[model samples]
Every structure is written in structure tokens, then in C-alpha cells.
Target: MTATDPVLRALAHPLRLRMLTLMWPGPLSAAELSRELDVSHALASQHLRRLSAVGLVELAEERDRRGGRERRYRTVHGSPLSDRRDGTPLLAGTLAHNLRERAGRRAPDSEGVTVDGELWVDPQVWQDVRGRLAALAAELHAAARPPHSPGTVPVGIGVMAFALQEEARPEGDGRPNPAGSGPG
Candidate 1:
């Protein structure tokens, strides 16, 4: 998918992102999502419909309970970020929004840890690190929930790396070397 795809645009919102995360593990009905997210049933259904419109989610099942049919929604696996060429910016923006929200609610030492540092390494090393990080993220996404638990909390993990550029040189050279090296 391209950056301008409706799916990417639809997934860019905070509430929609939260819904997708909640549905990652399995199928969830609008009522279940509403309870989990503390939202109204109509609001949850609206967002689910939006997600379904973009093909990011699908109707997994429908069951009759209490004289009404409950519609369950599940994320369309292998479709969310399958086209990486256009997903980076969207994912980065989402990550930044999530980080900002989390930071506003708690201190750095409260519930989660944040790591930030700069590293200068060979291109191959950088690629290896990126691959490893991608694997870890996939593992986290596919992880199974613990059965018979009270409730589950959502966590965000992010990894970013990019090359630094060199400073520009003077156009017309009559000036002394910045490093104080003469024409030796």
C-alpha cells in the first residue's frame, strides 16, 4: 500500500490505533471493545466500521446471543504494514503520539522504561540491528494472551535508527583548515 492509501490514513488516528492493538490478539465484538476502551457502544461501532472500510479489519464471525447477533472483528493479519515503503512515516507518527500520551500521564520511572542513544556503526551492523528489532516487534505482536487473567495492559515499543550527515565544506577555499592542518 502507498502512503496516501485510505488504510494508512484510517489507521493514523489514536483511537483507531488503540482499537487495532486491542484486536490484534483475536476477534472482538463492538460491545467488548467499547467495554475495554471505556467508550460508548456506538462510538466503538463507528470506529470498527471505519477500520473495516479500509480493509484493516474484517468481520470474523457473528453469533446469536440474547436474541441479537454479535459481530466480531479481527485485524487482517499480513496487511497492516505489508507494504513497508509507505508505512514508515505513518508508523513513526503513531509511535510519537503514543509516546507523548504515555509521557503526559506518568513519569519516566513509573511503569515503563525508555532507552535513547546514538551509535555509529557499519552499514551491515545497522541492518542487522534493524532486522533484530523487527523480529522482536513481530514476536510481541503475535504473543498470546495469558488465560484467566484479570486484565491486560497495552505496551508500546519503538526502535529508530538513521545515518548522520557530514558537515558541508566551504565553496571558495582561501580560509585556513578548520582542524588547523596546513598543506603538509
Candidate 2:
């Protein structure tokens, strides 16, 4: 999705991102969301309505409770759009917020995974590797079913691959390197 898309812009907010994360595992009412996020019901409802407007979330079910019908909302899509354009900064901020939240909760490294590596390969090989990584991500996302029992929490998974740019060095530099020197 383009950066100008309303849906993408709407999702760039930190509050909305947290709301989506809270609702990822299942449906939650506006009141419930407010209670969880420590916000007013009206404020929570406003954000929920905004999310609904873009079709990211939907009214899943309404039940009669205490002489009134309570509406529950659920996320319709669990994965981020792959066609994002010019939204990297927003996405990176959201991810950082998420990571910070998890860290605040003292989440162990075992609860999540991070992969970082650099490889030199032919362009075609890199393309194939990227495709395989995308396929694996899709497969894992598809296999993510709702929590079946207590003690289970929703897990967020993200995959990104890009070629790194080489740093340029000054030509005919006479300064000696402090950290060390020639590979030879």
C-alpha cells in the first residue's frame, strides 16, 4: 500500500498499532479495550471506528448481556500488506514500539526471534533466497491459529530482507586505522 493510503496512514498511529496487537488473538469490545489500555470508552471507540472504516477490523459478534447487546470486534487480516511503498519509517516506528512494549514486560528472548546476517551471492541467488524467505513467512502466518487454551498469547512475526550498501572510503587516505588494518 502507498503511504498516502488512508488505511496505511490510519495504521501509522501508535495507539492504533497497540489496539491491533491487543485484538489480534481474538475479539474485544470497545469497553474492554479502554479498560485494558487505560483510556476512556469514547476515545477507545473513536480509534476502533477509525480502524473499522478502513476495513482492517470488523464487528465479529454481538451478544445480549445485561439487557443490552455488546459488540465485539476482530481483526480481518493478520499480516501486513506486502506492497508497502514509502512507509518504512512508520513501520519501523511501530515495530520499535512493539519491541519496547515487550521489553517492558520482561519478555524473554525465547519468546521471540531475530535474525540478522549478511551474505554475498549472485543476484539470482539472492532473489531465490528472498522468495523462499517470503514463502516461509507466509506459511507461518497461515498456520497461526487462534489460541486454543489459556496461557497462550498472540505472537507477532516479521521478516525483512534487503541488500546492504557498502560504505565508501576516502581515496588516497593516509590516516592509519585505529581498529586495525589490511586483511592481508
TM-score of each: 0.73, 0.69
Clashes of each: 0, 1
Name the candidate that leads on TM-score.
1
List candidate 1 stretches off by more than 4 Å. 1-3, 82-90, 103-111, 117-119, 146-154, 160-184
Candidate 1 per-residue lDDT, tens place, 55-143, comes to 88989999998999999998887646543556577767886887787567564555666788776567799889878877877798888
Of candidate 2, the 10-residue stretch with the lowest lDDT total is: 175-184
Enumerate residue pairs that collide in model 2: 1-83
Q: For model 1, name the residue pairs that clash.
A: none
- Per-residue CA lDDT of candidate 2, range 57-162, in tens? 9999999978999999988865655646557767777767776665676546555666768866677998898789888877765554444436565565545567
Please give the range of 10 consecutive residues that has the lowest summed lDDT in model 1: 175-184
